[model samples]
Target: MLLTLIYLIASVTFIVGLKMLSNPATARNGNLIAAGGMTIAILGTIFLYEEDGQKLGNYGWIFGGIAVGTLIGFLAAKKVKMTAMPEMVSLFNGMGGACAMLISIVEFDHLFNKDSGVNFEWTAYPPLSALTSDSFFISALPMGQLLIILLGLIIGTVSFTGSMIAWGKLNGKVKDFSFKNQQVLNILMLVLIVAAASYLLWYCNQVGVKINVLTGMDNTNLPTESFFTNVKIIFYGLFVLSILYGVFFVLPIGGADMPVVISLLNSFTGVAAACGGFLYDNKVMLTGGILVGAAGTLLTILMCKAMNRSLANVLIGSFGGNKATGGGGAGKDQGTYKEISITDTAVVMAYANKVFIVPGYGLAVAQAQHVCHELEKLLESKGVEVKYAIHPVAGRMPGHMNVLLAEADVPYEKLLEMEHANEEFSTTDVVLVLGANDVVNPAAKTDPSSPIYGMPILDVELAKNVIVNKRSMKPGYAGIENDLFFQPKTSMLFGDAKKVLQDLVGEIKNL
Candidate 1:
């Protein structure tokens, strides 16, 4: 009863924490509350959980493993740079999948070895087996348990391998490699996994009668030796096939779609974890898993909608793999982009009635969020209204810019979404784009043939003056040239994001 009460508290805390996370004002506190609840849950499990009236032993090994994992997780979180946070999240999520997979493996071994203190009777029903005078039958395995095991195996393996592939792509360790038949190969592998799992379950049910007869053999202590051998072979085959399916599942997806893929894989891991909870009859684990699974799924759907693409298209089409072929209005005949001096840019921003700052991946790479915030405060002090324009998919992941800006103590109210920022651009005097490319490119609006066409973008061109800070004119991750750079109203401010922001801040202060 005490264990049940503790689990209830943990589950409630998880719900409350999740609710709080939706708003930036309470997010940090929400994280802490959730962590505290998890701590309580762990303590309750270690001290009070029992299996068939037997307590778990080996405290030394258990505590040692926990210590090592905690230390490693702490150090990794501290050392990972903001730019690498996406890959870090993928790596950690993959570890969660691995844990669920291992749990299924251990439970399967325990059941097969008859070490779990539960009695099993495998009985075959009609239509599945025929009755014969000489034939022997045993009760069928528990269908619920078997289903949970299979689900945990399949979903966990897929999450693990898919997340690893995402990590590789984000870190540039793996290139986008796809063939004409890539989608076909992925579909084939998925079908094979389903077929293999079905066959294994069917074979297990059928082999029970043969094993029953073998159990009656004279002078044999364990008569089901062949049963274990055959089942082990089938299990291993299913495991291998599932892993292969996961690899192919994410291989054909392009870089731009990674945020959605990451969320989808996260949902897979959550569902797999829920299977573990069901297998163990743990209520807290079940609740937590359900929450994560539902939230990740919703987030994935939302991200797909934001991109104006279907989830099926994202999985099957290689949208970002090829270099952009359409030039939009970025033809050479367009006037050469003019570079603006820091002093001139600073004077314009200082005198402007309203200023908008747009951030992107380059800002993350240059670790300029803090300095950028400094610039916002400086401009606001001069009675100029400053606001931040954030795109839904600005960085490698969703909410990337929000997190970075929050870390720098930027006010939540000042951060504006794409639509809100666009509405204000026409009234704004100057728009400062900090290391952003594709999100502000006019080609998305003007060129129907452009690769990024149909995607929502910031209308920075609508502002009276636009200044873009970039180290070079290199194309963005989508490999598309930005037509906004060639616009008459746009002026390139060539420098590293951090250096330019610092120089701009200094120049503004001097004025």
Candidate 2:
């Protein structure tokens, strides 16, 4: 009863925390609440959990593992730079997938080897001898139990390998890999996985049961040694196949779509975790997994919409690679770009009544959020209104720009999403783009051949004046030169984001 109550508390906290995450104001507190509830649940399980009239032991091992994990996690997060946050998220998510995969493997071993001189008295492994014939499969284990185990193993393995690949790609350790007919191979692998798993189920159902087809009668017996041998081979084979499939599944996806892929992989891990929860009949674990799965799936769909790409496109389209070509606009002439001096930019922004600043990946790369915020403050002091426009899919990961700006103590109200910012752009006096490129590029709407075409972008060109800060005239991650750079109303301010923002702050303070 106490464990049940603890589970209920943890479940409630998870729900509330997830809800709080929707709003930036309560996101921090909500995270803390959810973490606190998880701590309570862990303590309750470690101290009071019992099954089959036996309690948990090995306190030294359990606490030691937890301590090491806590220390590693703490140091990783504390020492990691803001720019590499996406890689860190991918790495941590991979760890969750690994945990689920390990759980499924351990549980499968216990289920199959319980009576073969391998006593698992420390665990709450259901006694095969005690299980009745009611609703039972003809196999050694229940059909539902076996299904959960296999699913957890396959999904967990896929998520682990896929997340690792994503981490590698984000950190520049791995590049996008694709070949001819990659999608066809991906589909074939999926079909093979389904067929193999289905055959295993059929084998388990008929391992020792001899059916007289002409007589239309069957005799069911216990599974034979041959069945165990075959099952082991098929199960392990399935595991390896899933790992390879995950590698291929993410290998062809372009860098531009990685945010969506990460969200999708996150959902896979959640589903795998939920399967483990089902295997263990743990309510808190089940609730947490379900919440994560649902939220991740929903967020993926929203991100897809924000990018103006379908989920299918992100998964199989192989859209944008990381090969940057700094030249004219995707084979078309964009003419020459005009440069703006620091003094001219400061004067334009200082005298303007309203200015909108759009942030992108370069801002994060340069770690200029603080100085950017400082420039905003200095401009606001001179009677100019400053607001930040955040593209949904901007930066390396989802919510990357928001987190960056938040770290610099920017007001939540001052940061506007693309949709809301677009409505105000036409009326604004000036739009200051900070290290942004493709997002403010007019090609997305005008040039159909552009890789980022049809994707939602901040309409910075609608403003009366436009000033973009970039280190070079290079194309963005989508590998297309921005048409906005060469526009008559646009002026480029070339420098590192941090240095430019510092210069702008100094210029605006004097103005």
Candidate 3:
């Protein structure tokens, strides 16, 4: 009854937390609520062992693992710099995949040894009993269970390795879009695994008997060694196949589509988890898997919408890989840049009736959120209207901009979505673009040849005057030029985002 109630509370919190996340205003509170619920669930699960003789098998080891994991998590969070945030997320996510893979392997070993009729003599401890006779024992060689276990190992390993590759790319350890001669190696691995699987299957078909032994006596029905061999082969084959598939699948994608890839990988993780739940007949695993799968799918859809692309197009075009060549020529013709001093730009902004600010990955790299907040405060004190324009898929992941802004204590109401801000851009007197490109590029709306042509952007070009703070005229992650910089109404202020903003704030004070 207590477990049931605890689960119910956790489930309700998860649902409510998701609902709260729908609005930027409630996102922080929602996250906290969800965290509280998870804490309760973990406590309830740990307490279950106290009631019965049932334990986690190794209590000291379990506690040690927990302690180490917690310390690592805390240190990583505290020590990881903002510039390395994407890599950190990838690393953490990879660890989750690794953990899941280990769990699936442990379960397989338990089932395999039990089916093989393995026995051991006991000394001081109670004599070992036959696990085969245990009611919880899934069929010794249940094909479905075997398949799920195989899938879990394959997907989990692929996710772990692939995510590490992503982290390398983000950290510049690997060049963006570089493909290695790994296809042949992967293919060879696949063939070897398949051959092993075939051999195991043939052996399994030859043996039709089941065996389980306990106390020097046959205990119950179980599959022979051939069955376990076949299961092992399947797992190995699938693991290799998944690794090859993941590498090739992501190899063609460009950095612009990374958000989609992240979401898709997250979905794969959930599916793997669901398979694990089926393997163990564990309800909590099932629930968590379903929730994660559904949420990840939904997030992928939103990311596509943010990019104004279809799921099919994203997959085939390899938008997240190296295949994306920026929509180039159109922006060059329309965008004409004029350099301006921070003082001049600040003067124009100070006298403006309304200002809209667009932030991007550059802001994250510069760690400029705090400075930006100060600028906003300065502008407000002068009675200048200020609003922030945020794209759904801006930065490296979903809600990235929102998270950055929230960290700086930006008011929730000050942040505006693309749609809402679009309607107001034309009425605004100034649009201050900080390290933004693709999200505000006019080429998406006008150039049919653009890879991101149909993507939704913050209509920053609609503002009467535009001020872009950038280190260079370099294209964004999409590798495309932004036409907004060339517009007659646009002016460039070249520098680091934080330095430029600080200078602008100083100038604004003088005005």
Candidate 4:
């Protein structure tokens, strides 16, 4: 009862924390509350849990594993740069998937160990007792329990392998891999997985496990050992197939669609964990899994919407670095771009009625969020209204740019979403684009031939003056030239994002 109370508290905390996570101001506190609840739950389970009146043992192995994992996680997080956050998230999520997968495997082993020499006399699982001669069910394991185990194993393996692939892709360790009719092949794999699982379930229900029948002598009516061994083989085969399917699942997906893929994989992991909870009847684990699964699914939908694509389109279209019609723009001439001086930019922003700052992956790569915030503060001190224009898909992951800016202590109210920022661009005086590309491209609206044509973009071009900071005129992930750079109103400010923001801060202060 005490352990149940602890789980209840933990479950409530999960719900409250998830609700608080929706708002930026409360997100940090929300994380802490959830973590505290989890810690309490773990402690209660370790000390108060008694399964069948058998107290938990192996404290050394349990705490030692915890210590090692905690140390590794702490070190990895501390050393990870903001730019590599997407990959890090994938790696950690993969670990969760792995844990769920192992749980399913271990539980299945414990229940179905063939060498245990324990004869089943209709006493193991009450659910199996109802089976008559014609009932034709195999093993002392209940069908319901077996289903949960299979579900967890399949989903967990898929999430684990898929997330690892995603992590590799995000870190540039793996390249997109696809072939002719790749989508068709993926569909076939899905069908096979379903077929195999169905066959296993049917086979188990069709025959009962051998009872009191040994092959020494007079075993004519005994169930053949070979038949039972085949059942075990089928289960192992299903596990292997799941691993292959997972690898292929994420291989064809392009980098731009990684945000949605990551979210989807996260949902898979959650559902798998929930299966484990159901298997063990753990309330806290179940609640946490449900929350994570639901949240990830919703986030996946939002990510797809932000990209202006359907979930199916994202999975099969493989739209990104692969479909690049290069040269940074359409075949037409866009004219030459003019470069702007830092001093001139500083003067324009300082005297301007309003200025809009747009951040992108380059800003993250340069670790310029802090300096960028500094620049914003300096501009505000001069009575210039400064606002940040945030595109939904600005960084590698959803809410990534928000997190980066938040780390620098930027005000949440000053950061505007794409829709609101677009509405304000027409009234803004100077637009400073920091290391952003595809999100600000005018071709998304003007050129149908471009890969990102139908995608929504921030209308930074609508502002009176546009200053774009980039290391070079290199195309972004879209692989097409951005015509926004060639616009008469646009001026290129070539430099590293951090250096440019630092210089801008100094120049603005001097003015």
TM-scores for all candidates? 0.87, 0.88, 0.81, 0.87
Q: What is the C-alpha lDDT of each candidate?
A: 0.84, 0.85, 0.74, 0.85
User: For each candidate, how many residue pairs have backbone atoms clashing (under 3 Å)?
Assistant: 7, 0, 7, 3
**Candidate order by TM-score, highest to lowest?**
2, 4, 1, 3
Model 4 agreement with the true structure over 248-298: per-residue lDDT tens digits: 899988877888999999999999989988988888888889889999999
Better of 1 and 3 by TM-score: 1
Off by over 4 Å in 4: 117-140, 209-223, 321-329, 332-335, 341-343, 381-383, 446-454, 503-511
lDDT of 1 by residue, 354-434 (tens): 999999988988999999999999999999999999999888788899889988999989999999999999999999998
lDDT of 3 by residue, 1-511 (tens): 6776786788778778878977767978998888888888777777662434565467677778889999989999899876567678777767877777777677667656665444211113223473445222222244455556666776677677767766666666755553554445545665665565455444433333323344333334445566566656666566667666666555555666766776777777877777776876655667777787799888888888888888777755443333345455543455358988988899998999899999988898899999999999999999999999998878887677887998899998999988899999999999999888888888788888777888888888789999998899887877777777887889999999999999889889887
Better of 1 and 3 by lDDT: 1
Better of 1 and 2 by TM-score: 2
Q: lDDT tens digits, residues 184-297, model 2?
A: 899999999989999987776553444444565667666666767778899888998999998999898877678888898999899998997898799988999988999999
Clashing residue pairs in candidate 1 are 121-139, 122-138, 122-139, 122-140, 123-138, 123-139, 123-140
